[model samples]
Structure formats: structure tokens, C-alpha cells
Target chain A: MDKLLRDKKAIVIFVAPAFLLFTFVLFIPICQSVYYSFCNYDALTKPEFIGLGNYKQLFTIDRTMKIAFKNSMFFLIFSVVTQLIAGLILAALLTNIKKGRDFFKNVYYLPCVLSSAALGLLWMFIFTPKLGINQVLAQFGIKGPLWLMDTKGYIILPMWVIASVSLWQYVGQSMMLYMAQISGISSSLYEASYIDGCTKAKAFRYITLPLIRPMVATAMSLNAIGSLKFFDLIFNMTEGGPNHMTDVLATHLYQQGFKYFKYGYASAIGTVLLVLCLIVTFIINKFVKVDNYEM
Target chain B: MTDYIKADGWIDTFNGGEGAFSQQTYDGKIYAVPLNIAAACVFYNTEMFETAGITTMPTDWQGLLDACEKLQAAGYTPLTISAGTAWCLSMLAGYLCDSEGVDLAALDAGTASWLDSNVVNATNKMVEISKYFQETAAGDTNDVATANFYNEEAAMLIQGSWAIAQINGANPDFENKCGVFAFPGTDGRVIAKSDSLAMSATTKNPDAVIAFMKYFTDDTAQKYTAEVGGKIPVTTVEYDASKAPAQLAYVMDVFGSAKSTFGFYNESMASTEAGSTFDDAMVAIYLGTPVEEGLQTVEDFYKNNVWNK
Candidate 1:
């Protein structure tokens, strides 16, 4: 094994399959999208080279593009902040509980495993004004605001509703990561802190949180990328409707590419989404400050 | 392939007569067989109409508005439409545009703008009637909106003939109470579309494909198209009117008496993008964008995207 690790040829042989697979499957398509973003390709005709035209239209004249960008940014910020706080609290609570820790974890994680498309439909029914939530609200003589239909503001009500749903479905993932990291910590540290007159909250703040920094970075990057590319939930819920008030970048790209057959423009949107995901991940990694804790 | 199918002779045999093959023709050559024709019109609840004391069917826009007023006064939601499904709202906009005589040819030719008086009036008319839509109109899917009509929660639904199957299927009891009429003030012009089948240019078995295509227009299938599917058969065929869903008979009468027929504006636009942009613009209007600003979105789309292309 030591000889194999030292050999350059053995290293190439071991790594070549995954390297080649990544180049063909991921790298090539990304390059093609970048290329298509600069052309006039409609998926039916041969691409005509029209440099910067699609990007210009997307940035300047496309009104829905602005809405999509704003909505995506909203989702990214909302998901990161809420998931971190909620997941950490849940993790801390579950760890300290004397009973029902596993039960609580499983219940929260159940939504994460279920299909987002089905969840989207279920939530759509629940939020529809004449039906689910509003129906219940009416019995108390309260008129529920159109939960998914009101499009009166810059960031509309439906976007907030979708963000909350997404948070509900995905916060479990971050919680589990934090729990794993928290459980790996030495219990002796808690005993030592208790002897030193440190409260459980202070111990959590000083010891558990620092030990979990690496996991937090991992969980947050996952969340940032996931929320930036959010599609299925919004697509199945509102289909970016009430006049595209809820369109994120992915939904806009889908409508342009598949529905409208504007492949070139859609590719431009896809490229922008890709850049956003990368920049967000970079920012999250930088801010979270993951370090190798000698625990 | 169109070259392999020998469509001209077969198309001539269609019972719908000369114009039956018109939609399938390209450069004087027929390439596909249409299974059924569909038209968009208003389907109303007769019982609800009677309850509202709407003695006369609306013949014009004012009468339609009056009918809505009476329905509202009688404590019924007058209309149910799916603004969530953009195409459904756009179809309604198409009828209004048809009634306003917004010239598609002139728009394409750059002789007319989408903000022209005719287009603006059509949008204004749409906004006026939209008030009668159910409270959840902006978020209801087509299925939900259709369910609203079949469940008798709303007095009327403006939908394509294809909804007949869904409506009857969801509530068989709705059949007895449903009535149909062409969109008011359109002078009987109906927005129509057809389900068409075309042979693949590379298919190896042309004879087999042709045999399958012929079956759609044959007497047995054409009759089923009307009696079972509740759609207008592309080929003329007679079936027992009593056996068909009651709404089918009303739809047939409207289709038969139409003074003119036009395609859905969203489906017939220069490109799918322009059509959807048009849909988005219509929805913006529905969601309370000023009519001029909403229509301006489409006009700008046409100038920047469609015309330049």
C-alpha cells in the first residue's frame, strides 16, 4: 500500500476513472452551457454565434430576471440564517434530552427524505386561500390573507411561504450534521466545565460550538448551494405564478429552456445560477471559518 | 414521412369536408390527421342562472356583465378561472382580444402595437370581468377552477371544450345543469384548437401508421370522440345525442354556429416565448398592474424579441 501510494503511475491509475467521469459528465456540460450562453441556440437549430447578446438581454431588458435574482437571494439568505439557528437549537436540545432524542430526530428528518414534488403539492393545497389553512382560519372569524396568491410586495407573501416550507423540509439535515459533531465531543469537557462552575449554556457556547465549527461549515455550504438552485418545491407549488412573483433562477431557466425553447437564454440563466452557487459556497466557507480542532 | 403517407387523397375523404384538412395543410400539402376539434366558451350552471334570475343568455359584453351582477347579487361567485395556470388566463385574454378585433396580422407587420386601443380595451374588459372571479382565482390551478364549477361553487367557467371530460368525470351530476355559450361580444368567434397526429419522417412502417391514423377519423372512433370524450370530432359523424354528455351537445351547437374560429393567441403567437410573455403580461394585469403597463410589457417583448428576431 505504501509503494502504491508513492508511485505516480499508480496514483494516476487510481484517480483516472473518477477524473475522466467528472470531466465528461460535469465539466463538459458546464462548458457547453457557458458556450451556449453566448450563442443563439434554440435546441432546434444550429447555434449562431452572437456574443454577449443573451447576457445583455437577461441583465437589461428581461423584467422577470430581476424578480428571479431577488427571489433567489431571498431564499439563500433565509435558508442559511434560519437553518443555522434552528438546526443548532434542535441539535442542542435533542442532545441534552433524557428521552425521545431519536424519536424527535426521526420525525424532523422524515420530511427531508420525502419527495419535494409531493410535498410541494401537499403544501399548495394547504396554503390555497379557499381550502386548507384559510378554511381553518375562517372558523375563528379570521380572514386569512391569500397565503400563496398575494403578490403585493417586492418579496411577495408566496416567496416567504415557500422559504418557510423549504426550511421545514431541510433544517433536519443541518440539525443531524450538528448533532453528529456535538456527539463526537468528549463528555469529559462537560464534566470539567461543570466542576469549573460553567453552566451548560456556557459550555455549549465555548466548547460544543467551537468543536462543531467544521460541521457547521459543511452544513451551511450544502444549504447555500441547495437554496440557490431551489426549483422543484417552487415549481410544483406555484409554478412561479401570480405573475412570476415567486420565480427563482432555476424555475426561470426551466421556463425559458423547456417551455419557451429559448435554450440560449436559459443557458445564460443557468450560468448565472452556477456562479451564484459557487460565490455563495465560497462566502459561507470563508465566514464559517472551519478549523481542525484537536479535540 | 409526409412524402410516404399519401395524405392528400386520405384527407379529401374526411367527413368534415373541404376545410377539415385546412389546419393540417402546409404549403397546400396535408401532413397530419386531426382527431378532434376544440373550442373555448363559457360553461354555466343552469340552476345557478335560474336562481340568479338570468332569464336570457348573454349575447354581448354588457349582458355578460349584467349576468355576473345578478349572479353576485343572488349570492353566487360569478366566475372561476385559473390565473395560476398562465395559459388559462391567456386564453381568456385571447377571447377578449378576439372580441376587440386586435389584428394579429397588423401586430406582426408592425402596423399595430400591443398597446393599441383595441388591445388596451380587451385588457380593460378582462380586468372588469375578473372581479367576478372566485376569491382564489389568482392561485387556483385549472383542475381546482374546474372543480369549483363542477362542485357548483361558482356559477360559470370559461374553458376550452376539452374540459368537458374532466367536468363530467368529477361530478356526473353537473351534466344535467350545465349550459354553454360562445364568449360574449365576439360575434360567435370561438377560439379553437385540434389534437393532430403526424407521421414521423423516419418511420419505417408508413402503411401501419396510415392505418392507425385512418382509424381516428373513421365513423366508430369519430362517434366515440363525441359520445365518450365529449369533444368535437374532426370528421363529421353522427352519434346518439342522448347518449353523449349534455355539455357535448351544447359545445357542438356553439362550434357549429360559430361565425369564425381562431387559434388561442398564446398557442398561435410567433414563438412560444412571446406567447408566454404575453401570458405573463395578462397575469400581471390580473394581479393589479396598471393595464397600460402590463400590456406595455408584451409590446416591449414584441419589439425587442419577436420583431428583432
Candidate 2:
């Protein structure tokens, strides 16, 4: 086995297939998107290089990019913080529950397992004014504002609504991860804290809290990235409508690429999204690097 | 060869597979057939009509409101709309305006505006419809609207002919209870949409598909579309008034004598926001935003943010 691992031919054979596949897929698309970023290729026309013009429009000329970026930032910061707390609380609750704990865990994780489209459809029905909660609210003499259709962007209603949806769909997943991380902490730490005359709350704060910090950071980072790239749910629920209140980077890119057929502009938006995600993930990974140092 | 297929939304007449053409031998004349279709007219329960005390399907503006009022009095919603998934509501809005002889095609191309008198009238009509739609039924979607009609709950549902197949395919039985009519406005003109067949350049069976198109466009096939398919024919094949929906027979005549047949509503126009994005304004309209604002939204979006920006 050692000799085979050291063999040059064996190495070549093993790496060749993966290398070819990567070159065909990963490298080509990145290269193509980069190349397309500077050109005007509308799928119908031959490409024409315009030299940073697409980026120029994305940064300065396009109003949508700014709105998308702003909305993304709001959700990224708000959802990560809010859902982390909500997930941890739920995880703690599940940990303490003496009855049907496994069943409750499965039920909590079910929404996260559903496709974004299915979640969005459910969200639509839940928030739709006439047939949904609003109708129920009417029985109590209340008329809720049209959640998805509201265009009065003064309050950022659409962003908050979409963020809440993302939270509902992803909090379960974060809860499960936090639960696992909490379980991994030795029970003896809690016992020691309690035996030393600390209360349950203090034991939880001193033991379970610090132990799951890495997991909380990881889950938050993952969910933040998820919101930044959120496309399908927003697309189906509102199609970025009511005067583009809920338009995001992904839907904007799709609109430019497929609907408007502005391929170069779309590529630039994609590159920006990729770079943003990478930068964000890198920053978050630094805080969680304590685990890597031990390994 | 003309490139289109049923999968692309033409009638499933012949060669209804991936290919575009079908064979035909009509009167010893051999030619390539074409796939084409149009929007349909619909009518609801006349009992609801009578409860509204509407004696006839309204032919003009006055009769239209009288019908609506009567339908309301009879405890049924008058209009059937499904604007969320489909742009039939927009089509109806456009149709009402076009019946007055406004050139909506030009308007769609940005040569006109919602500020135009005809457009304003259409907007007013929509506003009226929204306001008059029983508050209970105003915001409900199309399927519910159809269910309400079929279950004898509502008086009418204004939908395209393709919906006939869907209604017939359902568990609820209408069975000669529902009827259809031309949407009345503009003093007798009809607003309609047509679907067509065009062959792709990439197909290997172009000749065979063309042969299929020929068969599909023949008189016999045209009749199949008219009678069985619940769609009117592109060619001048006459329908037997005695056999089919009386409104359809008259529709065939009206289709023949139509001053103009608008292509599928703005949403069906390729590369336009009228379908995917701009057309989504229906939700906004239901939420109490004005129609002119909706039109202005698309127009401003086209001007400020789209290509050439």
C-alpha cells in the first residue's frame, strides 16, 4: 500500500480523472464567467468586449445592485444574530425535554429539509392577505398589509418578511447542529458546576454556552451565506415585484442574464456575489479556527 | 419550415410530439400545416345571471355593469380572475381597451402610455371591477374563482379556451351548464389571443414535422380543434352552430369578422417584462395601488434600469 501510494503512475492515474473533470467543469465555468464579465454577450449576439463597462454599470449605473446589496447586508447581520439566539434556545429546550425528544428534533428539522420553492410556496400562503393569516386576522377585526406585495419601501417590509421566511426555513437546521455541539460537551462539566453550588442557569452559561460557540459561529456563517445567495424563494414568492422591493442579487443576476439577456452584466454580478461570499466565509472561519489548531 | 410544437403551447393537433410538422392530404392539396390558437370567451351560470337579473350576457358597457350588479344582488361574485399565476387578468384589461380600437400592440412597444384615454378607460374599468368585485371574492385567485363558478357559487369566470379542457378534466361537472361569449366592449369588437407553430432549426425530422402540420391544419383537423379542442380554427372552416357551444359558433363567426386579433397578452410577447416581472403588478393592483402607477412602474423600469442603461 505504501509503495502504491508513492508510485508516480498510480498518482497520475488517480489525479488525471479528477483533474480532467475539474478542468472541464470548475475551471471552465469560472474562466467563462470571468471572460463574459467584460463582454456584451446576449446569447443571441457574438460577444463584444467592453472593458469593465459591466462592472461600471453594476457599481454606479445600476440602482438594483445597491438595493440588493443593502437588503443583503440587513438580512445577513440580522438573521445570523437573531436565528443564532433562537436556535440555541430551541436546542437547549430540546436537550432538557424528557419526553419525545427525538420526535421533536425531527419535526423541527423538517422545514429545513424542504426545498426553498416548497418553503416559499408555504410562505406565500401563510402571508397571502386574503386566504392566509390576514383573513384569520379579519375575524378579530384586523387587516394586515399585503406582505409580499407591499411596495412602500420606507420600512424595509419586504426584506424583513423574506428574512423571517429564511429564518423559519433554516432555524431548525441550526438548532440541530447546536444540539449536537451541546451534547458533545462532557456532562461532567455541568455536574461540576452544579456540585460547586452553581445554579442550572449558571452551569448552562459556563458550560454549554462556550462549548457551542464554534458551532454557533459556523451555523450563522452558513445561514448568512445562504441569505446572500437567496434566489428561488424570492423569485417564486414575489418575482421581485411591487416595484422591486424584494429584489436580491441572485434574482437580479437571473433577470439580467435570462430575461434581459444581458450576459456580461449578469457575469459581473455573479463575480461580485462569489467574491462577497468568499470574503464573508473567510472572516467567519477565523473565529472558529480554534478547533483547527487542536487538530 | 415554420418551427413550433405542441410542447411549445400550440394545440396538440398532429405531429404533437417534439417535431413541428404533420402530414395532410386535404382535397388533393398538399401543403405544410401550421399550429395556431387564440384566447377563448367564457360565461357563467345564468341563474346567477338572473339572480343578478341579467337577462343576457352584456354586449356593451351598460349591460356589463347591470350584469355585475345583478350578479352581486343574487349573492354571487361577477368576475373570475386568476392574475397570480397567469396574466389572464391583464389580457382582459387589455382586451377591454382594444375593443375600443386602441392599438395596444403599439402601446406595448412603448409608443403609448397608460395616460392615453383608451388606457385610462381600461384602467377605470379595472378599478371599477376591483371595487365592485364582492369584497369577499375580490382577492381570491383564479382556481377558486373557477370553483365558485362551477360549484354555482359565483356568476362568471372570464378565462381562455385552454381552460375548457382543464374544467372538463376536473371532478366537478358543469355538463352544458356553463356557456361562453365574446367579452363585450368597444361597441362589438372582440379581444383575442392566438398561439402559433414554428419549427426549430435544430430538428432532424423537419420534413416529417411539416407533413404533420399539413395534416393538423386540414379542415378535418381544424374542426377537431374547434369541436373537440374547444378552440377556434385559424383557417376559415365553419362550425355547425347546432353541434357546439352557441357562443363558440358565434365566436367562430366573430373570429372571422374580427377587426383584429391581438397576439397573446403582453406577457406572451418574448423578452418583455410584461410576462415575468412587469406582469406581476396584479398583486400590487389588488393591494390598492393604481393601474397607471403599475404601467408607469414598467415604463420607468424600462427607461431607467433595463438595456442601454
Q: Candidate 1, residues A45-69: lDDT per residue as tens digits?
A: 9998899999999999998899999
Docking class of 2: acceptable
Clashes of 2: 25
Candidate 1 backbone collisions, by pair: none
Worst 10 residues of 2 chain A by lDDT: A286-295
Residue-wise C-alpha lDDT for candidate 2, range B19-58, written one tens digit per residue: 2232322244323344445555656665666556566677
Q: Estimate candidate 2's RMSD in Å.
A: 5.9
Q: Tell me the TM-score of model 2.
A: 0.81
User: Which regions in candidate 2 have their CA more than 4 angstroms from the true location?
Assistant: A1-23, A56-71, A122-162, A283-295, B2-36, B40-42, B99-118, B134-141, B171-175, B236-247, B253-257, B267-270, B274-278, B281-283, B290-292, B304-309
Q: Considering only chain B, report the TM-score of each candidate against the true chain B.
A: 0.95, 0.75
Estimated TM-score per prediction? 0.96, 0.81
Error of 1 at B87 (Å): 1.9
Question: Per-residue lDDT of A97-205 in model 2, one digit per residue for the tens?
Answer: 9899999899888888888898887787787655688888999998777676556655467677888888877889899999998888777777778889999788778
Model 2 chain B weakest 10-residue run by lDDT = B17-26
Question: What is each candidate's DockQ, to 2 decimals?
Answer: 0.66, 0.31
